[model samples]
Target: MYQVRVLVLCGAHPLYTNWTAPRSTFTSLLPRAKDRHWSLLLHQGLPLNNMAIFAKAPTTCVSFLLPGPVIIQTDEASSEVLYPNYQNCWSLREKTRGRKKAAILQPGISKDLEKVKAGVGINSSDEVDFFVLLDNVAAEQVHSLLSCPALKRFAQMIEQRAVDTALYMLQEEDREGIQMAVGPFLHLLEGNLLKAADPTTPSGKTRKLYLYATHDVTLMPILMALGIFDHKWPPFAADLTMELYQHQESKEWFVQLYYHGEEQVPRGCPDKLCPLDKFLNTMSLYAVSPEKYHMLCSQAQTMELGE
Candidate 1:
């Protein structure tokens, strides 16, 4: 059996689900393209050939969600419409077309949060906005935990139930919320993305920092796949990071993962950092494709029907 570095044995990944192509078919040596930023390692069916792809491939990947999006989802605003002037308020951080945003929200909305603490609600304890209040309370509790000496242990205990529940829901073959969201995200790391760890040729190179702003719907599955999530749901503002490092002498790659600035150990690596080649070999199976993830998801429904 092929061993995975971090993920539990759920099943084959989307790319490997129905792949029957003979390994020998792709044996030709194809020259690298000059213009593109990243090339698939398996391009032209050859082995790892390019430096750019090797650079951007992060050794780490995982998930964690925040209260803001969760509150938005659960606050009966399924449509995702925000307050009138707030529609275009948030910025994408990255600038394009030589233009920058007016301003971007910091890691957490400390200023806005202070406003809430001052009673933006109809009343300090209104039930109509009670759910949002619950969110604020939970956020404050986590903030308090940061300074407590036993913060790590307390945080773990708090998150165990969330981790268990996320894992349980994702394991259900028929359920798509967590499972479907998970596969593509992992593929973005292992299957397609290139690493910037290795020094590149003189001109064309990929950037070292790749930043994405997304909600918790995308975070939980990744956490489950990595088997490293343990927290009482993501708080007001959370960060899940997958950092890659390269050895100066050996040229070997390593993956270090972090959540909200706290380092996490993936199950695959005993010391909590996975070897790059080993990590990719294990995760390659789950790499992206059109329909395989949904197909894998059907394993649940099929079992229930006994067909």
Candidate 2:
């Protein structure tokens, strides 16, 4: 049986890069800011993306993506744990997804099936439905705003601005975040591809698929790290796929990359198809070896100012 490892990553968070709430833009999304009591929500982790600014102090909210690797036996019928659930849909709008998208679903905090996890303010049926619709709105915004140029720049700027660690905790978080996910994925990639190419290896004859089911939070950093992300947001179900092929003529292997169905030329890949040897060599720099991802997590968190 082939043991395949898959990575699942994403988290809900709010990021502020030198914001000034009550700025002119706040009137655009939050018209009632002047009259409504927003500090409560703000304190409760409501993400106000470029939402004009709020406080003089920097904000620290938990919006993260980690590469959680789970090994599944490819030959087994019981390997259904990695799939998505068909039930339990939540449509809340309290939490914002990211810059390009507005607030969306933060479903009932249920850990197991059979019962609904009690939420803070979900008292009535109307509130429950409102939360569901909030999720829908967040999804709609994602569908409409993901590919904008501003998003690409926004993504790029986050990385660029992150260099100055005085503003935010981005430098370590961004790098460590990627090291957690991409690094592992790369490990799986290189190891599996090598196995597939080696005739002496026991599992060399088997074909494998390395799947990653992630939230946009983690995808943004990874895309940026790959140097292919144009700073725009990626929609749901979007995938960054890579395939390996063997050449019968030279007995060599090669790699092809794709992002959201479009062929992508990664930093090392000059063409649509890159020789597997070259691809590995080019990609070797990114895979964080010698250091475990959890090590990064164990360190203390930092807070920096925004540019």
Candidate 3:
């Protein structure tokens, strides 16, 4: 059987990190997987300043490209409307134009989570063929605006966008034989991983499987939601990483988590512009091993924050 090395890239920002450590690491790593097909999976967080670099290399064997960063504004009035019950106000506004929403909604968190559970075909006895990846940011602070009542109305809109993006890629004809990669909120990562990792189902039969959670500091709450950590702990102040690698011959996947150095970018994208090639080359050399990369994603459902 042929092995495909899929690289899922996401983090605080790429351009401003000096482009040497992580970049060089990744470059060296990709070529090492000799005899295997090398596929690059670009998640969210690529900077707007670096858009030119990505656009210039359209045919560079990229298996998937998610919509870039988006900004959400929470004005006082909007916040009041969205989080009326909490004695605090919250608002949700798009930071970037033409960006898409994240996931489909189902009334309440329980209901929405139920829908996600169903998507993984959890109840089915047969193995559903797919892998999962979750890209998110870590929210450093909990704003009263996050609890706004008005924001709830748009919940479904956000959920639909995220789900649609994954489903769309899954439906592509060329993707049939390849292992699946599912990206969801960090809070949802543990559950998704458990579901996808279940050994009883047919979906778990794939020889090689992977589930990636990509994000920056905004991943805190979702991690809390997943019970991975607690709110009292400072939000994931540094870059955190995790990996799940399946041994094709054994069908057993090894999972590990790592903490990379702290990144100081505010919105996730880099403050400066760097050529895409330079960045990719850097990634090739600096990419972390499954056991040592940090994860800094969030569970925000809106496009603005989702990216």
Model 3 regions lying over 4 Å from their true place = 1-184, 200-217, 223-238, 245-254, 261-307
- Candidate closest to the true structure, highest lDDT: 2
The lDDT per prediction is 0.40, 0.42, 0.29
Candidate 1 structure quality by residue, lDDT tens digits, 89-189: 11111111112111112222323333343444343333222223333334334233223333232344334433343344344232333334445456666
Q: Please write out the lDDT profile of model 3 over residues 261-300, one tens digit for every residue.
A: 3322121223223222232232232222222211201112
lDDT (tens digit, per residue) of candidate 2 on 170-212: 2223454445435555655677777877778776466555444
Q: Choose the strongest candidate by TM-score.
A: 2
| Two-way lDDT contest, 2 vs 3, winner | 2
Q: Which ten residues in a row have the lowest lDDT in candidate 2?
A: 85-94
Candidate 1 deviant stretches above 4 angstroms: 1-168, 172-179, 192-203, 281-287, 294-307
Cα RMSD for predicted model 2: 20.4
lDDT of 1: 0.40
TM-score of each: 0.42, 0.44, 0.25
Return model 1's CA RMSD, one decimal: 20.6
